[model samples]
Target chain A: DVKVTQSSRYLVKRTGEKVFLECVQDMDHENMFWYRQDPGLGLRLIYFSYDVKMKEKGDIPEGYSVSREKKERFSLILESASTNQTSMYLCASLNRDTTEAFFGQGTRLTVV
Target chain B: AQRVTQPEKLLSVFKGAPVELKCNYSYSGSPELFWYVQYSRQRLQLLLRHISRESIKGFTADLNKGETSFHLKKPFAQEEDSAMYYCALSGSGYGQNFVFGPGTRLSVLP
Candidate 1:
């Protein structure tokens, strides 16, 4: 089965601390995305990478950065953790050949 | 600009009732539409796509280019069908930038 694995299912961080959310896909998809799922906002794109070392800012890219150093791994970085940043983060990978996107289990981050 | 809209935020239905989750999109070019579902405690997954023209879990969606809508429908809803549904649109370049709607929460009460 195709899988997109996230490094953490839950995380807690202190204010002003640096936070990293890792996502890895075994399917070797060229496009990977990071989205924040909120109550009413649904999924808001944070960042996305179509190729290694190439990234694009999504609708809500402020206070966040992304790294795609390798083909299988994509990391989302929070410059400074704040209460407002606490939300459910979802990782997804999609192959250019198809429109289907595989998603990770998601990581619920709490900034305290 | 590509945008998706799900008019209803919440819809409630009893068992064996018909259910329809509306989805509308605004895109200049030919848009690839999709319906994604998320069950309780489960990750979000694709429920159906417009291109496939197949039914899944008793749900199906039709892409209406004229109306600019792709709505999900099920004739008889089951209790297990309760979940969150999101409408998405993919532009050119093979879904490099996917836009999702606000999502509609379906509550199928037994």
Candidate 2:
């Protein structure tokens, strides 16, 4: 089965702290994405990487950055955590052959 | 710019009732539409794609170019079918990022 694994299921951080959320896929997909889910907001794309070492900003990329140093891993970074940043973060991997994306179990992050 | 909308945030139906989830999109060019589902405690997954034109787990979606809508339907709703459904739109433009709708939460009552 195809699997996209997120590093954490739940995380709590203090305000002004740096936060890192990691995602890894075993399918060797060429495209990886990071999104944050909020009530009535759905999933807003934060960043996506189409190839190793290449990154693109999505609609809601502010206050967030991404690192794709390797093919299997894509990491989302928050420069400074704030209460507004608390949300369920999802990671997905998509291959070139299909438009469908496989998602991870998501990480619920809380900033206080 | 491409956008997707799922107007209803919460929908409930008794078991064996017909189910329909509406989705609409706006894009300048031809777009590929998809339905994604997430069950309780399960990872999100693709339920169906417009290009395939196939029914998945008793759910089907049709793309209407004139209306710019891709709605998912099922003949019967089951308790197991309760999930969070998201409509997504992907275009060939430079944006490349897939845009997803706000999503609808379906609850099938016993």
Candidate 3:
């Protein structure tokens, strides 16, 4: 089975603090994505990386940045966290062809 | 722009009853539709895709381009069938980025 692991399952941070959420995939997939899921808003893409060091902004990328220094790891960074940034963050990885994406156990972030 | 829509926010049914989760899409070019399910305390997983045309756990979905819909259906609902169902669409563009709908939560009562 493909495994996608997230660094933290739950995190709480004070306002204006820097936060990082890490994700790693053992499948060596070329595509990785970061999304924030909200109750009524659904899963909105924050950022995605197609290759090492390559990134693209999704629908809601504000206040967030991503790093893909290596193929197996992708990191989401909040330069300065705010209360509104609290959410269930999910990471996913997919192979070259857009088959099925494997997701990690989401990290529930609480920005107080 | 490509988009997926699951109009219903919640759908409840009794065990052994028929169930259908509606999903609609809007895209000019060819579309690839998919259904993803997330059960309580479980990671999200793929339930079915239109291209496969195969039934999974007695659930099936047919992509109707004429109607621009891909509704998921099952003959008998079970307690295990309760989950959050999301409808997604992969763009016809090169990247194949997926756009997901606001999911529908299904509850199968006993």
Interface RMSD of each: 1.5, 1.8, 1.2
Chain A TM-score for each candidate, in the given order?
Answer: 0.97, 0.97, 0.96
Q: Specify the highest-TM-score model's number.
A: 1
Candidate 1 chain B TM? 0.97
Residues B1-110 of candidate 2: C-alpha lDDT, one tens digit per residue: 88999999999999999999999999998999999998888888899999999999999999999999999999999999999999998876443678899999999999
lDDT of 1 by residue, B1-100 (tens): 8889998999999999999999999999888899999999998999999999999999999999999999999999999999999999878774369889
Worst 10-residue lDDT window, candidate 2 chain B: B90-99
Ranking by DockQ: 1, 2, 3
Please list the residue runs of candidate 1 whose C-alpha ends up more than 4 Å from where it truly belongs after superposition.
none
TM-score of candidate 3 relative to the true fold: 0.96
DockQ of 3: 0.65
- Clashing residue pairs in candidate 3 are none
Q: Name the weakest run of 10 consecutive residues (lDDT summed) in model 1 chain B.
A: B90-99
Model 3, range B1-110, lDDT digits (tens) per residue?
A: 77788889999999999999999999999888989999999998889888889899999999999999999999999999999999988765445676789999999999
lDDT of 3 at B88: 83
